[model samples]
Each structure stands twice: as C-alpha cells, then as structure tokens.
Target: MKALSESHYWATNKKKSKETDQLSPFKVLVRKEVSDHVHSWRFILLLALVLLTFFASLYISMSNIRASFSNVNDPDHAFLYLKLLSATDGSMPPFHILMSFLAPLLGITMGFDAINSEQNSGSLTRLLAQPVYRDNILLAKFYSAMLIIATLFISLTLLMIGGGLFFTGVRIESQEFLRIIGFSVLTIVYVGFYLSLSIMLSVAFRHASTSALTALGIWLFFTVFYPILVNLAIRAFLPDAAYLTQGEKLAYNELIMDIMRVAPGQLYSDGATTMLMPSIRSLGPMSMEQLSGAIPSPLPLRESLIIVWPQLTGLLAGSIAFFALSYYLFMRREIRS
Candidate 1:
C-alpha cells in the first residue's frame, strides 16, 4: 500500500511538471530564437544592408531637396518646402521599396534551413527527444523571424523619419506620423507573409538550398515578373476594354481593381496612395462633389475609417490568410528524413 501511494505521488508530480512544460513552450521557444538570432551572421549582414540602403536613399532625397531650394526664386519658398515635405508622402520611401524586395530574401534565408539544418546536424532528433513539441519548434521559429523582421522594419522607419526631419527641416504632422507607423506595420505584415511561406518551404524541402531557391523564384514571380505578366494578361484579354466610355470603363476598371487586390503589395500600394494623398478625393464611380456629399460635412476619423475600411481589411485579411496557410502546412509536415 505504501509503495503504491508513493508511485501515485510520483506520477502526479511528473504529470504536473509535464503540464507546466507544455504551457510555457512559446516562451521557451522565443528565448531560444532570440538567442539564435543574436548570434547569426545573417542577422548582422541584413541589418547592415538595410541601414546602408536607408542612408543612401535619404542622401539622394536630401540632395534633390537642396537643389530645388537653391533653384528657388524666393529666399523663403514656402511652396518648395511644402513639396519637399510631401516628397515622402503618398508612396513608400525608395529605400522601403528596396527593403520590401529584400525582405523576402532575408526571410527565406533565415527560415529555409530552420528544420533541415537541425535535421542534418541531428539536433532535431535530440530536441524532439526532449519534452518539446514539434509544433512548438515551428511556432518558435516563425515568431523569432517575425520579431526580427519587425525590428528591422521599425529601425528603418525611424531612420527615414529622422532623416526626413534632419535634411528637410520639417516637423512631421501627427497624421503624417501616424501614416508612417501604419506603413511600417503594413511592411511588417508583408514580410510576415513571406516569412511564414519560407517556414513552410523549409519544412517541405529537405535541402535548405532548394527551399531558398523555391522562395526566391516565388518572390521574383510575385514582385518583379508577376506585375508584367498581369499587365500583359490584362491587355491581351481586354484590348478594347481600356477604350470604353468613361462610365462603363469606370465600372470595368473597378471590377479589375477588386480582382487585382488579391496581390497584397499592389493592394497596399493602392490603399496607401489613396490614404496619404489628400488630393485624391475621388476613386472610381464617384465624383469629388459626390464623395464629399456622401460623407459628413467635416469628415471625422471614424468616417475616414469607414471609407478606407474595405481596403484596410482586404490587405490585412489577405496577409493573415497567407500566413495561416503557411503555418498549417508547416505544422503538418513530417520532420523525419
């Protein structure tokens, strides 16, 4: 009876310990990921590259602004300053464009070997042999990549804002500041999508190089070649559609635009332009007067949200869906060689 009681107590304690371990998996994973990232040469190189690109872009923009000021007729050219201030408006920074192109490559580079490298080194078996769950490992890797990518984006954003203020001598308005933050968040979401895809590919492919190559191919297809292909496809299929009457063309164009919003980058670009540019009061089937009349006399924040809500939701939803799909595929993948 005594021995049985002892055994029961031990079993209870063991189960309690296991439960505790399972409950804290994410924290453990995050810690390990943070540690690994700190030691990675890739992380350092990526940071350096991003910083370099950002500074270079800032210099170019400043140089142009200075030239414009020098060529000004009035010593106090308020209009020239306003134009300089608005330079960073509407679209993303040029450096951000470069970063977006580079972000996937960095994500793929970081994630392509996540599982395969461990498997190759025989660390995966040993790690799995411990109390850790397979799903935890995948989640940890993803979270780590996201954390790192987000940090990089934040750093780039601060750099741009600082550079803009320093070179242009313009104080960023509250709205403009908020817009920059929104742009950064959008960028992080975009990078997150690619990171999750990379994680999925890492799990799917045995060779890290194969995963990287596949990711690069997809990135090129989506970013560089896809737009060209889309344009060609649109032109080929709708040759006469572009020449239609204004009202009919607007309806057709709206339909096409809705379909094209499937691509997050394009969607982001369109939505961002519309939001940042105060001059763009009308978009599709609505005249400026009609749009102004549709809203409250003085548009409040909520009203503005209501107007762009569809676009904001669409871009965010698409990003979430892509990441979710990647996560599902990654979790289901077998780690065995």
Candidate 2:
C-alpha cells in the first residue's frame, strides 16, 4: 500500500510540473517585464512628474471650477464633474492637455529600449534558447507595457473622479462616468501609438539611444515643426483669397483640418476635447444650413462619441499598424550572441 501511494504521488507531481512548464514562459516574461518597469528609476521619475502635473491641474481646476460655469442657467453647469477635468484657471492648462503631451513620453520611455537593450545585452539569444518563442518576446513586451499604461491611466482617472467629488460634493452621473471611461480608453489607445512606434524603432535600430532619439524626434516634429510646415504648405499652395465664396472658404478650412488630423497629436486633442466637452456640437466648420435649428444645449454621451468616432478609429488603427511593423521586424531579425 505504501509503495502504491508513493508512486501515485510521484505521478501527480510530474503531471503538475508539466502543466507549469507549459504555462510559465509567456506569463513569466510578462510579469518580469512589468516588474522591471515598476522598479526602474526612469519609470519612477516619469510617473512622479506625471503625478505632479496631475495634482497641479486638479488643484487649479478645483479652484476655478465655479468660474467655469458662472452662468447658473448654462446647460454645461449640469456637468460639474467634467468641468473638473476641462476647466483651466488660465494659470495652467487643463489636465487632459497636459496628459496628451506627457502620455506619449511615458509610452516612449517604457518601450524605446524594449528589444534593442535585450539584444545588446546578449539576453535575447539566451531567452530564445529557452522554450519561449520569438513572437512571445515581442508580444510579451508590448502587452506588458500596455498593461502598465492602462493601469496608470485608469488609476489617474479614478483619482481625478475622487478629487472632483471631494472638492465639489457632486457625484458623477452615469453619462459623465461613461464619458470619462471613454476618455480613459481613448488615452490608452493614444499612448499605445507612441509605445508601438518606439518599439518599432527599437527593433529597427540596434542601439537604444538611437531608438530613443528617433522617437523623440518624431514627437517633436509632430508637436512643433509639422504643424508649422503644414501651415506653410497650405499658405503656399491652397491659399485662401478674398474673392473665394463662403462654400469655397469652408471647404478650404476643412481640407486644412483634415490634413492636420494626420498628426497624432491633433487627433488626440480633437478626441480628448470632444470627449470632455459635451457642449461642442461639431468638429469642423458647419454650413449655415447645417447649423439651422440646432440647439445650443449639451449633447448626450452618444452624440459626443459620434463626433469623435473617426479620431478614435484613427488612433486605434495607427497603434495596431505600428505594433504589426514591430512584430514583423523582431521576428525576421537575426538573434546573435
């Protein structure tokens, strides 16, 4: 009886070990990546900077919250919770604007060295020598970074909600909550675009610094130089003239906006603005006929989403495309020690 029981125990242990071996590689890689990010000094510093700016924006917004809707009769006054996010004291910009700028840096910092550093340090070869597949490495890194980004943004959103509640003694309505949730998801997608771009650069460039600099350069160009160049090009080519009719001018302005939306920053801004501001009815110049009989009241959550749907789709599609590029590059690259 003792011999039979011992053999049963050994067999059970063996089976469990096999199951563990089968499941461990991908999960272990993801956990390791997440742990490193959480413990790293660079991540710590960036998180602190984000938090500081968040608190400053929150304080400023709370201070001037009442002033944001001074007209008690205004329909927007009903959304005091949202006002906490979009309101600015003119001393500092609102939280979403600050976030739109800083979030990309956070994404870039997390992913700029994801692959190159591993390859440079001679870990990629050994990692692949294990049971883990090449695709698992790239997928684990991207998913882990995205998990961290999602957590950080969700926590920040909750903190903003709590802070607004405490400051104004107003609870968030269902529609307001949904809008905030939409904004948070939009933010994650927006940041994912940068993260994937940086990862793609990391795979394309052998050195981590090169990838980092390239990502920053792209961001700087979009944030500063790209808009200037677009303006210059428009002025030079599609110049608006006094002789142009109202329809022609409107079409020209819309054409400019469509071109500007190609920049990720503009897309994020338009989406964030539309998500946060329920009173904004249209994104582009509307004809007098289209504006006729339109109410000035705040739109429902669904209507606001409709206004920003194209922006959301664009950000999501861009992120996926960049990640796909990174995956392709990482898979085809030679792993040498």
Model 1: per-residue Cα lDDT over 144-204, one tens digit each = 8788788877887676677667766778666556556665676676667677677777777
After superposition, which runs of candidate 1 have C-alpha atoms over 4 Å from their true positions?
Answer: 1-23, 66-93, 163-170, 239-243, 274-278, 282-312
lDDT of 2 by residue, 60-134 (tens): 878887777686666677787788788886898898899879989998999999999999999888989988888
Q: TM-scores across all candidates?
A: 0.74, 0.93
The whole-model lDDT of each prediction reads: 0.66, 0.90
Q: Pairing residues by index, what is the TM-score of model 2? A: 0.93
| Whole-model alpha-carbon lDDT for candidate 2 | 0.90
Total residue pair clashes for candidate 2 = 0
Indicate which candidate wins on lDDT: 2
lDDT of 1: 0.66
Candidate 2: regions farther than 4 A off: 1-19
